[model samples]
Target: MSDANWKVAAERDLMSLGGRPRLFESGSGSYVTDDAGREHLDFLGGIAVNSLGHAHPVFVSAVAEQAAKLAHVSNLFASQPQLDLAARLKRLAGTGEDGRVFLANAGSEANETALKLARLHGNPRGKTAILSLAGAFHGRSIGALSITPKAAYQDPFAPLLPDTRTIEPTLDALEHAFAADDVAAIFIEPIQGEAGVRELPDGFLARARELTRRHDALLILDEVQTGSGRTGEWFAFQLPGMLPDGELPDAVTFAKAVGAGFPLGGLITFGRASDLFAPGMHNSTFGGNPLASHVADRVLAHVEDEGLLANVTRRGAQLREAVSALPGVSGTRGAGLLIGIALERPIAADVVAHALDGGLIVNAPAPDTIRIAPAFTVGDPEIEDFIRRFGDALNAASQSSETTA
Candidate 1:
């Protein structure tokens, strides 16, 4: 069938989220081939989920082997892979022996699990308020959405979980919110991915840590977009200067790259936070199943073994440096392989469309920001290809803007 036919069928059959999506037949490494047989460089990396890129040997092998051996045993049973992954996630989060893990199906589920933890901790003390930054994007579930603070995404689903508030991302705002002593927890993204990859103000995290600790509230860092070595660290909270030495968040939610495109997510809790969830309090039938657990564990191992974190750091710097020199570019934000290109004009959508036409894939999270979160395995070749294609796209967008003007 023709690409046009596929698109027409998609429009007819699929729900209209943002219109019909581009039809891609396959992908390998840093590129995806559309149904029309055009290969596009995948700089978005499935929104930072494809850690080793598409169809990595390690990822495929793990999935196949685990499926053949064992896939689903439900939550009632425990598997080696499940236990191993839990231990590994605890280590990665620096949660020590007191840490515990709750596996789930996606970022939304992970955040929901974190929400339950907050309730478990707060209900006894009559603390029910939940705080999130103004521009934060946690997830779309009712519980997660309540803390996300986006009007467009939340307004449609009115009467959300109560007592949720969006506050400014400032020290004073945090202080004011907690002064009431009603906040059960505060959800923060080390780097706000949906808010155009905006990082929190310097020292904001450490200060939040102090405030939450003082108020006896849980500090949950949503690392769904920045975890699994995306920020050149095991977790964003572990990044240098993100938190003081020997300091840690009460709990951390993770997904995306940890599964390397597999539908897997989890919440890791530290210290007393780990003990809050009683066994019967929460559960998922498919969570921590053998297949997803094995695959996620292997993905994390591959990222560590292949030294992809270093690659993320190095390639991120290179991509930012090259992109900054391009026409129409104002600057770049984000760390490691997750980056947001700021445009001189609010033409990021046009640039993204041009980039797609030029056989490169990117997304405009905001009017003036183009987000690029390529595979952690990207190296010089991928970087060079991206520069060449993206440069052409920028030039074309600039020319079109001039013509329109």
Candidate 2:
């Protein structure tokens, strides 16, 4: 099939999710092939969804085996896979003592679950206002959108969940928000993925922890893009620079790559927040099905067994340094494999288009910043190839912009 044929059918059959023009037919490891058989180095990794990259044998095998045995059972019953996945996550989250897991199908739902849990935790005290960072991207749902802080996404919806506020991600700003005394929870992303892979300052996050503790409010960390060893650590909050002395959030939401391309997301709640949800509060039918839970378990095992976190740390440093040295590149930021390269000029869209044409897949999350979330399994060779192609793409896009100007 031709790209044109797929695109035409997509336009007729699918709603606009604002996707790339090309159609990908298959993927393996760190590369994807389009309908025309052109291969592209997929640095985006399905927007940080394919943690183990494409067609990973372990993940494929686990999902296939589980499906053959038992695919799904409603939440009305208990399953070992679901309990096993929750146990693994609880250990990874460092919330084993007093933590529980609420399984959902995606990052947005996980966050939504967290929000509801926080509200429930604070309902007795009349603390219902939710605060988040100004440049965060939580999700597209009405409740998530309320805290997301993007007007373009929120304005069309008009009237989102009430009392959701976005404050600048600063200690002083956080202090001010906490002073209100009615805040139920503060939703923060340890590293804002859609906001150009921006990292919240270590000091700011620490201050948030302190303030939320003092105010008796829940500190919810959205690690949808930063968890599952994507940031060299099990969770970005666990990064030494962020919270070295084993400090943990009240609740942390994770999804994205957890299922290794299958949809899976949930939250790890600690202390009092763990018991917030009662029997009839909230639930999802297909949240922790055996197939997804088993695949997630395999992904977790693959990361630990292969020691991919160390690779992410090494490759991330190497790639950041290489990309920073390129012309038209300003600087780089982010932890581990989640990196953002700032351009000297606002031509990221053009650069992304050029990179795509040159068999690369990168994202322009901001007008002047390009975000790269390669799979944890990416290697030095893939990093080097991306740098070479990205440099060329940047130059081509820059020159084209200059000529047009």
lDDT of each: 0.92, 0.90
Candidate 2, TM-score vs. the true structure? 0.98
Give the winner by lDDT.
Answer: 1
Where does model 2 exceed 4 Å of error? none
Candidate 1: stretches off by over 4 Å: none
Per-model C-alpha RMSD? 1.0, 1.0
- Residues 45-138, candidate 2, lDDT per residue (tens digit)? 8898898999999888998899899988888988899989999999988997789998889999998998898788778999988999989999
lDDT of 2: 0.90
